[model samples]
Target: MKHVIALDVGGTGMKAALVGAEGELLYEARRETGRERGPEAVVEGILAFAAELRGYGIEHYGEPASAAGVAIPGVVDAEKGVAVFAANLGWENVPLRDLLTERLGGLPVALGHDVRTGGYAEGRLGAGRDADRFLFLALGTGIAGAIGIDGVIEPGAHGGAGEIGHVVVRPGGVPCGCGQRGCLERLASASAVTAAWSAATGDPRATAADCSRAVDAGDPRALAVWEEAVEALADGLLTAITLLDPRTLIIGGGLAEAGDTLFVPLRAAVASRITFQQLPSIVPATLKDTAGCLGAALLAWDLLDTEVRA
Candidate 1:
């Protein structure tokens, strides 16, 4: 009846799951992060949520969780278990792993970057499972990447390795939130597509989904916007391929939901641009939204194994 606690904390919400030893999910829950209430409240909410999961495990399974893993957005120093900074949650240098351990009666906890953790799940159990080296990119509100090598995601020297979003794809074209002009996120992310569609269609509420519909309907304007985003994305990805040489590229997030509308042209665009680098098989992510939670569970399980070995 032993289990691990897995939590994926986002800007506005948190998803948690109790996972059995063999990776089966025993229970799942979701809660608001209450980020608007401030950083302290968000921390408190996370602690309380973990505690509730622990209680639930003991009540339902007759055993408390032995370990925990937490995935948080923004800059995270996984080795030190510190959440370096998360603008959405107003966090800075928060020692989240130790706090969660203390709240959970000294249970070991593994902390990770949200995107990296999700990519870990995808690499181990989803799109990149067959590849020794792969890159996972999520094109959501913003674009981010995780580099997976031999089943492990590399966090880099400063825990900021796969930040492909900030890479300038359009020189001096558009302003980015990171104080840079023409970032990849500004050009290729779902939010970017939605913004373009909204402006083009004169619909203030137009979303990326609407843009996809328009593209499907053969709307020339929507096609133009979609192709523009795809081209920018291909440019950014080419830079990554030249540097990393991943065997596979896994694409996920809200925009990827468009399926062939995004992938068909993207593969061709990337193919046309490659000069010397080997072409990577670009595939859609299979795990979807459950990746982060499942990956947190994987981290918890890894920690547990390490502890037992020690």
Candidate 2:
């Protein structure tokens, strides 16, 4: 059975799979990224993980993986197959693609920004499947987005596009690690909600999921926190909608797991704020946490197809 190795590299962990030509996941696995050790350690972890997957394919599938793909956090020079910078991983201008290819014995490898790769998968196989234009928002530990146009996720000129989370929705409100004050991400991300809920309950262990539960129980404090997040997210989304005019908006990541708790209010809030902007069809991503891994597989398949065509 022919297969390709696919890996999704996150700040703390990695999801990997061996995908058959028909896009079925022949095998799946997960492991820590080992980022706590250091940036170099993280790179080593990724290389080791990919090599292991290659070996697995060779053993179980009767042949070595023909190609590999990885989706990673932070700035990526996809065209050059380099991970430019990842603040969380403390890396700068890492030639990650070459390292992975070399580790996998020169297998063709494709590298992409994590959010963009996931969004592309959503556009192709999930919520935004038929949409001509859409924006995929990931409300995770930090917020990020990818603009999908005609089934392709646009990587922008500098690989920094679809940064809807960075829009200053509340100037001078809260400082963000991005060195920006009151960016939407600081107020609307899952981590932001966790922080707000923790501070409100005076419990360091309180999380965004707790906040969502509290909201379900009609707790005023949780309501306040959730409301703030929704408002800020709406403002930020409006900015994107005005600029992109996407026909659909696919919401994903941890926050989206809130389901109606996040989507109901989010839709209402966005609708309440729109003046002339089109109210995009807001929908939750169907892929959940597995989107990145599936997307990585898609990237690997795309690489193979491109090579065959060339």
Candidate 3:
């Protein structure tokens, strides 16, 4: 079977894997990005990770892979293989594709936005696979989304689309890092949920995970905080549904890990908001943290296959 190396670069770490064309991971590894060292250092870390995957591929498949796919958190110029901007990683206009190509000895490389790749994986092989139209919403430290329409993941102009978190949820509520007050992220993101609970109870120690656990344990403060987040998230989903009318809403990232603690109330809130409109079924992501890596691999496969045909 043909194989490709896939890497998902995040602010904290990088996940690398050698994957078969059939989506089976042959080998995987993880390493910290050490992002504080700057963009070149982060790129070096990725190259090293890819080199390890190359070594693993040679050990198992008898030859190093000729293609690689990498997903990075931020606005990625997929057509140019440039990471346009990564606020968390403090990068700007990095020509990652050219560097990866040189490092991999002229091998083909596919670069993409991290969230878009995750949505691509879900649309092709995970929870959103069966839907002709779907939304991949990830509520992590911040919130973002990806739109999958008819099996095509739309990255939009400049590859910065699907930033649903920037949408205003409250008119004059909490301020957001993006210079907006009451943005969806301010009310519904993991950080926001934790902050809300913390402020509500004057407990600086309270966190989103703690609030989730509290909600699970019937803590009223946790319940109230979670309820507010769920309601805000539902409002955002309601707006997305009205516009995109997706068939499925795939929820992923750290916040979604709360399972029923997050989903039950979220689903109900969504149900309560819709009257004449159709409500998309909400489901958790199946690929978890690996979705971006797998999707990057798929992108690599697609790019290489297209080149071969050309």
Clashing pairs in 1: none
Report the alpha-carbon TM-score of model 1 versus the true structure.
0.98
Residue-wise C-alpha lDDT for candidate 1, range 1-310, written one tens digit per residue: 9999999999989999999887788999999999989999999999999999999999999989989999999999888899999999999999999999999999999999999999999999899999999999999989999999999999898899899999999999899999999999998899999999999999999999999999999999999999999999999999999999999999999999999999999999999999999999999999999999999999999998888899
* lDDT per model vs. reference: 0.96, 0.92, 0.90
How many residue pairs in model 3 have overlapping backbones?
0
Predicted structure 2, TM vs. truth:
0.98
Ranking by lDDT: 1, 2, 3
lDDT of 2 by residue, 1-310 (tens): 8888889999888999998887788899999988889999899888888888888888887899988989999999998999999988999999998898888888999998999899988998889999999999999989999999998888888999988888999999899888989999999999999999999999999999999999999999999999999999999998999999999999999999999999999999999989988899999999987789888889989999999999
Off by over 4 Å in 3: 201-203
Question: In order, how many clashes per candidate?
Answer: 0, 0, 0
On a 0 to 100 scale, what is the lDDT of residue 20 in model 1? 87
Error of 3 at 230 (Å): 0.6
By summed lDDT, the worst window of 10 consecutive residues in model 1 runs over 19-28
Q: Compute the lDDT of residue 286 as modeled in candidate 2.
A: 98
